[model samples]
Target: MPHLQTVFAAVLLCGAAHAQNMIRGEYWIDQDLGFGANNSFALAQQPDVASIQLPISLNGFSPGVHTIGIRTIDASGHWSLTNFSTAVVTTEPEPPLLTRVEYFLDQDPGFGEGTEVWSGTGTDAPGIGSLPDVSALAPGSHTLFVRTIDSAGHWSLTVHAPIVITAPDVASDIVRVEVFNLTTANDPGFGSAAALTVTEPQINLVEAALWSDDPLSIAQGNTLAVRSMDSNGKWSLTNFFSADVVHTNVADLFTQTGITTYPNPFSEGITVRSEDGQPLRVVLYDPQGKLVHDKVLNGETYIDLGQHASGTYTAFFWKELERIHRVQLVKH
Candidate 1:
């Protein structure tokens, strides 16, 4: 390629004295041609502050970074310090075309050593390309470095981007099973229901007792929503089931079972008493007939109702299969 020529111009104060006229100036490029040993030029009118335009030729200079420096001689014939400017020279009319593209994950494997995605495309730009399988990589933050090679076999600077390989979801064992009554507005949502022991991955509700304080009742045709959580704390989608509803008349079943419940109208909590100090079960239901609370206690036990909304609730006292007494309680 033929050498490229460029003009370097600079406004210079001739040796710091504005009153002193600039008589002559000289400039040299690349190699310092040593003071007046290089080419010299005369200044017209010998102006004190000279706007000098130095024409430099890169006749034998190779295509790369080069510098040009210029200094002026005052009327007193004293040489001023040289002022330098740098530039890059290339023989190509335009930037080289991208011929190859390669990338490496996490660590850089050096230029031309990365996994090649494209080769000799002979284009100035390359669009999105396919990457190798990263399934073997561990989960966590990672980096991907990419670089390109030109038609001249010159590799461009490596460009890096962050690559995140998140940990895949692993199968987890079911830890707890819970149920909710979808038909009632008092449904405590998921995770709020009383947790049932999960002995296996699959659960059979028919064998599972629904006597907990959760709003789920053993009612037929009522949509019973069931969900299970795994050891990873992830909950499964609720599965709905409807079955036969059983009903027993409280007035007909009251048999003086020696179980007494007090404070029909109360706030916060209510107390259930087994007058005979015998063990008995108490089940409280919401206005929608969804079982809200169920527990077996000996003597007296207090149940918190303060968190419940202001409405009428029913409590059924039971001695095993026999229903002893029922009472309507109000919460403020």
Candidate 2:
């Protein structure tokens, strides 16, 4: 006879169409005790299909070799085939522990050449108390590689972490700032936009109203773009805000703008006629104020709208940075 050993029995049972609930289960070791006659056990609950974990006794037999079988019975009195498994019991051995950890920056100094961060007798070395100085390294990106050796002298795969070094900041002067139009025909181009006078190296707020002799046409949707220049003559990217209605001089909208759009209630597409043959940007927005189409046109250009849903949309015509005309369009 042997001391009783607890074996974890994972039992799974499939129910037949005539049977839905698994009602009981049993297990036997080494020899057959016939169905429903082996060591029976009670399940916590009855389910249509059963998957459960229970403990089976491994006693009254030698530890050298043994076989265990499990089965279940359903409400319809159908017994599942035995799930047989073999067990081999033996004494356990001691496990290895972590003995050392080493790390290197940028380059691999090779095995023992890396600075040792930890050395002790333990299963784990949690944290590194001391780190190498990085002040001498140049300002840029670098990688730190780390590895560990176990008590059995086995080295793990090297792991690395990326690091970035930031340099000290230098003062830059604010020479000038400018404002311009992006879609208007009178775009002064980059450094050519109207400059705003400034005397400080850094500024938080800017107060100035920029105007053009020939401004963007009076429309609901219009923008004025502005940017700043450093003393090094580098111009910042344009920042735009909605333009307020200052004054209005009604020009010949059709003749002066030199643009025309045909097929008012268009089905498939529409045509834009540019009389002066200059490049113009056309943008269309759907009823919910979503932009549906946008393109730059030169001479006479045809825009196909066959893919858009049937709805009323607003179209804005722009010459360079200036918006010259805006009209409502219907697609049927």
Candidate 3:
């Protein structure tokens, strides 16, 4: 009975001491004798506890099995016995990339969102021919977006390809096409001075804008109206496109770009940079993953976002095929 009471007292004392000590984890690769705490705290609690998701650098470790250790160091400078866990390190597979593209008429009901017929379920692979059997599509014009999914289930961005399904002998379907200028001048005479005459009816699509070549040439207010003609020489309805011009007053720069943004919900412009001594190319994407801007930098660059609508954006810094850094940008 006396021995039992002594053991109980010792256990209680250890638990009380631990309540005041700061507990942390350390790691040792393979059979290394020395332990290091380069990693973040796995667990830390006093009266209250918090969880942090900060990225831990693991550059020093190679692909192999390693044992990780955790211990407690109290305020009185006493070290606790290290507890260990085993870990296996392996390389993560790279995402697959789209190589080739071909399209056919989609005959299946409720298939794709766009006008083109497509099947979403298929084998995603690298170097494998992804040509869909087009022998079933009807004669018409369509488009397809091709993407690849890596073995790790990471899907790559899509790329668009145009496809034309020609009829037995089709011609002379076009008539006269009309466009309207709704910005600086509201034109009724089929846009500008006159309407466009479709001498060759095979043209399925028409595109025009005030800044067709130079985007900067467009002013603060501008819009474009466009439509097409079919084989019966009958004109289709008109589609309108508008643009909101923006200000380009930005001048300050930065030094590094490991997740950095200023005025968080920023206006007018945003500054970006990275530690990469060489020039950096920053690619900006909207919330929908649509690319909005691409710029090259020499240490620092001021991106004019005054014209862009207020929203959250993602910025990725690239070094050739490798993505060096990624961060979020907010525009007010």
Candidate 4:
């Protein structure tokens, strides 16, 4: 008879000897034929040797049936025949999911390039779907989608949900202002309310401005003065009033004085100065406190204001030690 091949029989063996059995195993990718091997051994008295398992690298392995095998090595230095097993692995790529969706208006009224349009959702997997109505887009981009995790921990495929954003029209009555009648009128102040009849156009303009160079703030009981240019480029004050604060854009305050910004109402280039004569560090932020520029100034620093539209900005100056000064700068 053939030499006793006790591999399978050894796998079924019980008691302490079963635990002492040593198993040598190997696996191979069916197509590439790349192979890997590992070995494991248990105490002789342990029963049911089937509990031992081996790990294999499934990466880049094609989806199909693969063969695996294990053998026993006896204390006498004799190798048993291989007892083989097979399994099938599958590889499937899941598409990205649309987790969040939002809608908003754009600034610089009139629908066109640079006008407010729906922005796709934020995701790492893949592209977002196209929006439903292009006409409703304002004069800027709006966040259209958001990525979210599901309960099962698996992300769903991408889905494009419809968004309806109304664009503002060119009209003097786009926004309305009403001053509140306060009993304490002599308090050296006035409270007012601003309302938008044509929300699309008015909101679009504000949203555009907020999204552009700096983020905008909406706070309760705050005054807002809006100036808009229509599709025909006709300039008009759409709304000017003090209302129950809805949003407030806080100006960034920089305490560093080591550097100074020249030309208060700058048109072109503004000079940054340092008092210590050391390399000066400068940073620029919009009213919303977002960093637009960060750099170290060698000698004198020149910043181009032509690219930025007329607006107020915060300039922060610093050095190796600490923040020295922060001041407001205006670009026209």
lDDT values, one for every candidate: 0.68, 0.69, 0.47, 0.44
User: TM per model?
Assistant: 0.38, 0.41, 0.24, 0.25
Which clashing pairs does model 1 show? 220-243, 220-244, 220-245
Compute the lDDT of residue 212 as modeled in candidate 4.
27
Q: Which candidate is the best by TM-score?
A: 2
lDDT at residue 186 of model 3 (Cα atoms) = 60
Where does candidate 2 clash, by residue pair?
Answer: 182-321, 183-320, 183-321, 183-322, 184-320, 184-321, 184-322
lDDT of 2 by residue, 1-332 (tens): 34457778676655565635677888888888898889897755465655667776665556566888888787778887787777655444455688899988999988867888888988789778666667888999999888988888888899998988898765677677666545454667877766655645674312232222223233343556667777777766767765432221113435657677878788988888878897776677766777766666678989888888788877767663433466778889
lDDT of 3 by residue, 71-167 (tens): 4445445545554555555666443443322232333122122232322334443343556556666778776555444334454555667788786
Predict model 4's lDDT versus the native. 0.44
Error of 2 at 65 (Å): 6.3
TM-score ranking from best candidate downward:
2, 1, 4, 3
The TM-score, computed over Cα atoms with residue i paired to residue i, of candidate 2 is 0.41
Q: Candidate 1: count the clashes.
A: 3
The list of candidate 4 runs beyond 4 A from truth reads 1-50, 56-63, 77-82, 89-133, 136-158, 165-181, 184-332
Give per-model CA RMSD.
14.4, 19.7, 31.6, 23.7
RMSD of 4: 23.7
lDDT of 1 by residue, 1-332 (tens): 74476756664544754556677777777778787887788876455554566666677678888887778877766788787777667785765788888888987777788888877656655555676668889988888888888888888888888888888789877778887666763558778875766656765542243333333343323456677888889888876655433343333333355555556577788777765786666778877777778776777888887777778887666554322355677776
Which one wins by TM-score: 1 or 4?
1
